[model samples]
Target: MAEEMKRMIALGFEGSANKIGVGVVTLDGTILSNPRHTYITPPGQGFLPRETAQHHLQHVLPLVKEALKTARVTPDDLDCLCYTKGPGMGAPLQVAAIVVRVLSQLWKKPIVAVNHCVAHIEMGRIVTGAIDPVVLYVSGGNTQVIAYSEGKYRIFGETIDIAVGNCLDRFARVLTLSNDPSPGYNIEQVAKKGEKFIDLPYVVKGMDVSFSGILSFIEATAEEKLKNNECTPADLCYSLQETLFAMLVEITERAMAHCDKRDVLIVGGVGCNEQLQEMMRIMCSERGGNLYATDDRYCIDNGAMIAYTGLLAFAHGTTTPLEESIFTQRFRTDEVHAIWREKEATEKKAN
Candidate 1:
């Protein structure tokens, strides 16, 4: 029977946080279609969780429709549906969860709730083909250093409070920088034009990291310096980038040392930073190790990675029963059982 051709199609929903990204991916790791919908919280919105959820609800359907059209696939063609399980806004996740559940029911297929962080890691692997690399996820709400251990994905280190991207966004907001597209983009532009590095605290707790303190220190310094005419925005931008990227790279290097792994894979929105990528590449090269990253297609929020990971999960026969499945606000990466390899092995044996 040739093991039923080992075929599968997955539709991924990523309404976690602010990005309403959707895509269709195939079992061969090919991204058939991807569409992204981005929303920026107004400055005075105060990080209201409910507001973020509403934002996601408004954009999910349109993004999904575009993705399906781009992939030239219909809902009926999807073998399963996948969504970010947790570590995101309750309402936003619910929006995606509800959509996935309804779609699964309509298509008479299963749903696979995936960990957002794990999806990032798996995407790195798929794009870069880096086996067992130390993975770093730096995004709006997360900063984690992960390595696969035993039967679980182990978090060797992570943010004690705020994530790296959050720090940059908050700082950009304080300066009243543009948020039309993204605050990160403005910060990166400023950092490039800047010539000096304003001093900022580097907080590293063993393997764990804390960016809140650094963010606060930078804000205070900026205010005091502006009053005393001590620093400029360009200089401040340069300094902030240096400090933040250094802290991230340092911990990643330490993780590599601790794990004795040479391969490093970085994912998430912040992973798009060229400076950070350069730093990691230098560190990896210095250690005679390899480093991998994705282009904007996979780095910035997109559904392709989710769809890819979902395809692997579905192919391995790991699925969530529609009735019992629900969106999770605190899904952990290690909770996902690794089934990709096993499923492939079984298929080969059967053949």
Candidate 2:
């Protein structure tokens, strides 16, 4: 089994968002080489969707080449081409999909387009070995509680508007936090120095959650307080972290209640937030549930997750034909067929 898996080289492309990452991963989750790199739109350059896509188009090939070189692997050595399918900008996804298609033909390998969100969740599962945990995916574009159900992964709960990470990033931008550094990281830094807690709206809907109201409230409060020089940026940052993480923890605990799950796994970029993880740990422990998280290698946006998921899909024979090869802007989590152990079984039978 190990030998067979080694024979497969999964080259993953992640252009679903601002980051354009390419990695080469094997079946056992061993990232043979993932040359880390990122593409950033210039500061004060507000979100230009098409321009972002164009930036991805410009960098995709160079990044992939650098990754393959770093991995010391040739094009013919690769067995599959994988890319982030959706839940991101259409233009950037198209760039990745087109590249994958061209590479599939060049290398005569299978192409797999995977759900970006599901890829993040699967990365957590692979890294943490959380067999049946309820997933809390918090990122710039998404925030949701997901569980595998029926033949598809279902969204137990999610944000009604902007994602938690997006909320944080917007707030950070407003506060002139580090633009070069990741927002979540910078927010975590500022959060530690905060001395006082400020109240923010806590909006929860059954199992679902919303951050827009809370974000607006915080922004307004920050603006009003700034006029009086009432609070330091660090204080506001810490207070914001506490409030937002508490909301996330509340929602996750509620979902666990409905699911009766004993394992909780967090994923995506926001998973790196220490405050969020700490709150989730406390909440899960209070509920007699275990909490797991992926390390930095798997947490932030990367191509490794795409390659890993694509390898699973390919091994399970859930393939796509060229005619049907197109990216969706909003692919749902439930759209994918979960085949973890089943994939191993089929691979065994094939041999």
Candidate 3:
């Protein structure tokens, strides 16, 4: 009764990339508020870490005020403060870390250093109610096939070079596509008008996928092909999306089979694509499994994911000391021991 009655709330800040977000969440899976602003670059350009950090510096405080107002919670109401610790741009990642540190000092609250990738997985799990599903985490910075094993989110497969979303973003830049909302989002929209299926490159080395080769080929030939009317921009977008999504699906399926898991959970920024979701759904259905997914609100980088995941850690008696709450740019998802998870698969069975 006491456990059920206890309510722990966390205020989280996320500025690991172009987006700066603030969110408030409770241990009971209640999201009081999740507000964010993205630092959108002009068409055909990507956001640099330094400029992105400057943007975050300009907007973090306002977003925090907005989040608190939206949640109707004061600093005293929060049980803990949370912020993403790593696996993101160094400059942008530090903005959130510093903000959380200041807040921790002011409010006298404990801090929880969250792994960004794990936050995405935990957010997907809570939103979709997926239990023990193989995770396909696709984003601008990461691409991985993950599963739970022995108290950890194990990486079964991953990208060898550029991420899947990075491929799409660069392709969009090559075509001079708009980045108003996002390059990947625009690519998905343009791909809908694509009729021809232009083959580029298919690279799958074991469970790892490589997008750099495919992207480089596209970059070299997209202009020439478009100039010669060999393939429309839509066709190129379509073909690129198809190849990337297919590679992801392939690795995810292999992980599922290897893990003997029947459910698949898609997470991260690129996971918001409906076409990718449908393809994964079909694959899951064919294998008599389930596909768990969330929309853009949860899939994209946001503070609620950090808050909720942090609350989970806090509830598990996990806290980050002030001196140890520093950020990094290369924290792997598999490095976090998911102490909140009660049950884990002991080992992978032989295939």
Candidate 4:
């Protein structure tokens, strides 16, 4: 009874890729502190696993301490520890799991393993107050259109090859753009000046999308076109964004229609783009639906989402054993059994 009366808190660690984030969250979805550091490579380059893992190790502990300090909570105040378990870079995922394992042993708190995709959706729902929304998750490593069904956030559609963010990042590199904040962000900023839209390859097969062909085509011809003054960087950026976001909106709307849902939730880092959000909003509005999104804080990979999802799972009797606390790089979103949403799914289906 006394333990039940106490406010349950979770300390979460997310080092699934270039970003290393630590956050303190309560069971009621209140975020006390979320601090993170991103490992940015030089322009025209992408971060590799070894370097990214080292970066996570260098900053994770300090960030954890800072999160605790800012949240005004100690290890004793936390009820559990959580971390991103899969669907990320292997070495980077291991960094968070290793840290959480040590913390669990020291603090004598239970551990909860969270799926990264599920965390994104859960965080968007909590922040935007969106319920039963068809989600479009676009990030550096993943791109998927998802909806809840049969107690899982099922993937209705996804990228067949490289993700949309990767395509945008590669295009930014071709333009020799800065990666200070993000490649996608730089592309968005430059795209604002674009007037004429040069036609690019638009590939959409059913509910899935493919960007490798477009990226290869752009990589081969962008510089030549720029040198010949055939197309400006802004025009290229604008065309690429329009083509890709249209494919995304198409598939997301398809999923929404298939699920009979009226709300759209955009998650992951690439969802932070205003252009993408606007396109999705227009599509949702045409369908008499609402579009939901968040800023960089919750949209990018962060520990707050992991903490909140793990807290929800923990409250619903989910726990991770020490031996089973392992990292998987290819875990799919549908692989997770969302015990917390079982009742909701059943009721929704019944209705």
RMSD, every candidate, angstroms: 2.6, 2.7, 3.0, 1.9
Candidate 2, residues 77-141, lDDT tens digits: the string is 88788888898988878888999888888788888879898899878888898877899999989
- lDDT of the candidates, in the order given: 0.82, 0.82, 0.92, 0.92
For residues 212-247, what per-residue lDDT tens digits would candidate 3 score against the true structure? 999989887787888899989999999999999999
Per-residue lDDT of model 4, residues 18-94, tens digit only: 99999999876889999999999999888899999999999999999999999999999998899999889999999
Q: TM-score for candidate 4, please give it.
A: 0.96
Superposition TM-score, candidate 1 onto the true structure: 0.93
Which pairs, if any, clash in model 4? none
Candidate 3: deviation at residue 198, Å?
0.7
Q: Candidate 1 clashing pairs?
A: none
- Listed per model in order, the count of residue pairs whose N, CA or C atoms clash below 3 Å is 0, 0, 0, 0
lDDT for 54 in candidate 3 is 97
lDDT of 1 by residue, 1-351 (tens): 334434578889887777788988877677888888777766523355687778777888888888989999887888888988776888878888898888877788788878888888888888888877899898888899988875567889899998898999889987888775678777888888887667678888999889898888989988898779787787888899999888889899999999999988999988888888899999999999988998778887778777788778777667888776777778777787767745544667799
Which is superior by lDDT, 1 or 3?
Answer: 3
Worst 10 residues of 4 by lDDT: 1-10
TM-score of each: 0.93, 0.93, 0.96, 0.96
Off by over 4 Å in 1: 1-6, 42-47, 341-351
lDDT of 1: 0.82
Q: Stretches of candidate 3 above 4 Å error? A: 1-6, 343-351
For candidate 1, what's the RMSD?
Answer: 2.6
